[model samples]
Target chain A: METTTMIGQLPEVTYAGVIIKAIIILAVISAVAGFGTYVERKVLAFMQRRLGPMHVGPFGLLQIAADGIKLFTKEDIVPQHANRFIFMVAPVITAATAFIALAGVPVFPDFVIPQEVPLLGGIFVPSIASDVNVGILIVIGMMAAGLYGPLLAGMAQANKWGIIGAARTAIQFLSYEVVTGLSILAPIMIVGSLSFVEFNNYQGEHEVWLVFYQPVAFVLFLIAGFAETNRTPFDLLEHEAEIISGYATEYSGMRWGMFFIGEYANMITISVIASMVFLGGYNDLWIFPAALMIVLKIAFFFFLMLWVRASWPHIRPDQLMWLCWKVLMPIGVINMLITGIAVMLVLE
Target chain B: MENFLAQITTIEGFAFYLFSALTIVLFWITVMSKNVLYAMTALASGMVLISGFFFILGADFLGVVQLIVYVGAVMALYSFAMMFFDATRNIKENNTNSAIVFVLGGLSALALVLIFAAPIHNESIQALYPMHEGVGNAQDVGIILFTKYLIPFEVAAVMLLVAMIAGIILAGKKMDNSLTESMDEDVEDEIMKRKDLK
Candidate 1:
């Protein structure tokens, strides 16, 4: 798994190196992101005090595989009246956008799985394929890109309800994206660099995790995270009764699976990001190993999201907007200011 | 010998060919697909291909931004709209002006190719700098935005605020009530004048 350290020097292969690195990254993230669906369901089942996927191999570990097969084997139906192009490609966009965003993130130090392998562990390498300096901006940009899938899917269906749902999702995404950007200001200010590595290094020196210093920001982040992911309380994108699965209503079989996988994969990405910024990231916690700490933190946040799903009913679409704009927006801005001030005071 | 292979990177050319085809085919599919939804999806793939081109051009941030903003925001916006309207009617005209749109789109693509062709002549420079570091890097971008581009950035924020207000109003629905409330006082004044006439 940690084969990265085995390679030495910057990955200065031929002109082809860039293409190879990108392809590999895309493949790996897609697999992991696809697997994230398995994790979500298993966790949700456990929280509900029910046996999850006992029927599927070994506590439902193969559940996602089973689901994939089912989707692939199923019919790939396109509505007769539907525009063939957008409908088919919408899922591809949704899935690709979700996974591409993962490329900017470093899953662990020296070993974002593909970037660098820590030489000490015989697994670290310094080369991270390519680092987009504006990793955060890229990520935010992708968030917006990923939204297109749902909108296109719903609209392509040509159903009135589908169109309404798509419209709702777009509006929902626009409102939440602001808070998402604003919440990140704290971490950005502290690091003074948009490079993910610098941000990670800032955390390394602090050792105290941004969550401790900026609890408000953390809370705001979670709120924004919920909206950003379009999850419970903010999942008006697919609020069944009102608009059905929103954009996903018209989609069935494998076409639907792209969106299904993309959503959970993004959840994992967001959870990992939450851990990276607010938790110590991959840093060691107490006596545990760095990997273990990261796992625990990610699990805690991921479960928390599911837990909220179970505990809280979804909010109405209108309330969701109000929360992002009137409430979360102000809080995000204030948090940005407070974090900026704190960083200034400390650095000064 | 190695250098020649390195130039096309067999892998590089192959992936580029594959993705480019995927993009074109998908772009056609997006427009021609009777399901408007399929068209949006195809459009997303087309944009993803555009990002691939950005990648090939060595514009890392631009590529990523293409993925993030276009796929994430713009495509997402496109998808949401598709959802709003049944996109099953593929044969009919969707855009305000199809002829102009095609002409402009073609022109832009041609312009881009011409602009980039000049830079490709310097092979060594191209090899060294896949992406223009100063332009795309966040740190550099931040300084420029905060300094020379600060006003624009602020203005953009102001504009976004206006957009947000508009979104709330439109999405919130029941605009008639607000409209009535705003016009109520004026209506009352007219009513009083009418009463005098009576």
Candidate 2:
């Protein structure tokens, strides 16, 4: 968070530092995304009273590596009637947007590479890759733009199921985006800044996590975040039972793997956002370092997503839209209104 | 070559030229492509690249809003509408009179250039809300929108609300009909009508 030190502000950030940070984010998040699949399977298996992926390696820890090999080595296929260009590009869009959204998110606290570290020595890497003022908006915008990936993928595949999936992607994503924005609006209103660091610092200053003040917003954001990431219970986009993997019906090999990585990456992004905005971010807590605290908070949210997935049943597409527009969106708007009134009263 | 390369490679200059080139190419594709999906995609990307200009101007809030409203929401809705039609099919343009089109197009272009240039030529143009130095971009935008431009902003919002209501009303016609069933019947009737016309 402190971009400068007592030694007269050492250049703010170097290009090498930024580039190194980008590589770390991409590499670490991608690896974590792959590892997340393994974790999800293991968690779901334990919940269902079955051994999942035991044969791959010790308790299936190595399954992620095995799956990576399979995905990479498998033959890529394009449907005969598919739009080759868009079909090929769609998965990349999903992955790219997901990663780009993370650019605005502060994944870890800023750190300096020691002088002993050869090429990148003595460079200070900021927590956020591009520390824009409109960090929240960029994350939301990028995620919203990610809808094109599934929409195009389904449409370009020329399959009826894929088209239906694409339609669901449009409506589901569009509707949920409003709720996500509105839900976060309360916190933004209270903090009076769009930057994530500002939100974190606001909570630290107040000595209260925003979730305590804006519980409704926290709940609303969690729900909308679930829908945005296309997780279970709201994953009507590719609800395999209904539309046979929806937009991904025609996808195979690494292309499909890219979608999986994107989905998991988005899951992590949403979790990081929730943790930072509501759970005091990487702020130090009793007996825990700042970094550890943030990590634990993110892990808890990730597990919560998996736990809910294992427990809940998928809702109907109609019910999903009804819940979004009728229920969640209204609650979000009301929460924002109340927060606005409270802020006004306090100011007065 | 060294001087040119140095000028071109300054991050800001390089980014400006890159985004401009991409935006132009995308807009060109949007206009010329026969496939509706390609056109829609190009148009959306062009809108996104246009937002880069806002970022270049230090209007980070405005840039993100452009990304969200134009590229994220509006273009997405366009694509959603495309689902109802045969989007992959080539659209035939009736270029029956090229001379009239060229004349009209050139006139409009010239008019737009003049309208844009007029503001620059007149030194009387001043910032209605001169942005304060240390204020964040979002705060600056909010201050301007709520104070200086509140009336116009509200009017624009009302106009959008009206358009949205109208869209819902039009789309909600025959809302009780099952889309798949109706689409089948509609397709059959359409083919028959086309056959009759032919």
Candidate 3:
């Protein structure tokens, strides 16, 4: 009777459950990162009115697999003058930090495996790897630390272009991090919690998303998020036109692939955070389940990123810095202050 | 081996040992490495491991703050090290008075350790604020910081603002010096032209 009662209640988590969830997250996110490249190519091709990667598989679905094989089999080259250890470790650091940041993110709604399963029955898996109270802060902090990856990589390569790339990475990432933090501060103040779960719960309970109240913050965050992930328009760190692949000039084969994976993973993380904080996160709307809604929101954000990349021309480095320090940062701070006052007034 | 595995299976014990080991090793690497870049990298890792220790102690807010401030923001200083110095060149430490300095450093460290460990050894340690049930770590920190430590916090903020202003002034002075030097050169050139005409 007790066992049945326990089972009827919310499923309990075990060590095995955490491990399984982590593995699932790693595998699924990496696969999705690969698939994102295919989507980007197709989206850009459509914009340019050309077929992209049609020769690999059906509509180039297997292009990612082919690319993977090529990256793995291609000759791994280290420049003769490069700092060997740092050169090798840099790309791995980028990839590792990107995946580590995902730990705080709630990728899906919590679920339990049925009790009938052999040896691993009725295990609860929370949406987040660790439901840290400072989830958003940690995620952003880890992403910020990822700046060292490019900074070191560029400096280690013993190439003039790489050094320029590293310098750009430092300035770009540092300036935009302030914007990202301040923009998110307004929502954090309103919700009075940094946990993504609380953010989601607030939206659900209030029947309103934070974006409605903090529109300026949402816009600032979106712009800063694009720059943080080193996406187009603000991708000065690795701008091909100027720096010739930037910090990645000396990397080849799997090393280069790691940087690509890191970039895509970061893009996905930004989309997830945006949807959770600004959009109504993982909550049922109309007829759709919460899980499906979140996935749709994330997909839409990802597509938006690609659309913007295709449509917009890259900005000059000076313009990027000016926009970050002068325009977006001031807007973020003012937005945060307004939200704080409004929240205080409502409470009183 | 069985006991070790059992101890490690307990999350708290496992985390404590792991973070402690990482901190010690990384700290050594930071201090002893010949390459400045490697030392900076090791120092960053050490700082991160210290944050891990905070996490294990359930001070989540402090852990995240440490990460953001030390690992993220402070790294800008390390980036300057790369630009100002050629990383490929081996950094050789001067050995003058090395023995005397090492002895003094070791003695001070030992004294410091003894001073800290003496209290814990006596079993006289008391918790100032025993953690209460239903109070989150962040809330507790915020409450204490704003209420009890408000003045100190504000002072620290002011100090940081002053430091930022000082940095700006210092950088501005360098630029101003260059501009004045350029003007002096132009004036000297005009004087030489007048002398030649005479």
Query: Would you list the rank order by DockQ, best first?
Result: 2, 1, 3
* Per-model fnat list: 0.79, 0.49, 0.36
Instruction: Give the poorly placed runs of model 1, Cα more than 4 Å off.
Output: A1-46, A49-68, A108-130, A345-348, B1-86, B90-136, B145-198
Give the deviation of candidate 3 from the true structure as CA RMSD: 4.3
Query: For each prediction, how big is the interface RMSD?
Result: 4.6, 2.8, 4.4
Model 3: DockQ vs. true structure: 0.37
Q: Chain A TM-score per model, please list them.
A: 0.86, 0.97, 0.96
lDDT values of the candidates?
0.71, 0.90, 0.87
Better of 1 and 3 by TM-score: 3
Error of 1 at B87 (Å): 2.7
**Candidate 1 C-alpha error for residue B36, in Å:** 6.9
Q: Which stretches of candidate 2 lie over 4 Å from their true place?
A: A1-11, B1-7, B117-128, B164-198
- Measured with C-alpha atoms, the lDDT of residue B103 in candidate 1 is 99
Q: What DockQ does predicted model 2 obtain?
A: 0.43
Over A188-207, each residue of candidate 2 has an lDDT whose tens digit, in order, gives 99999898888888887787
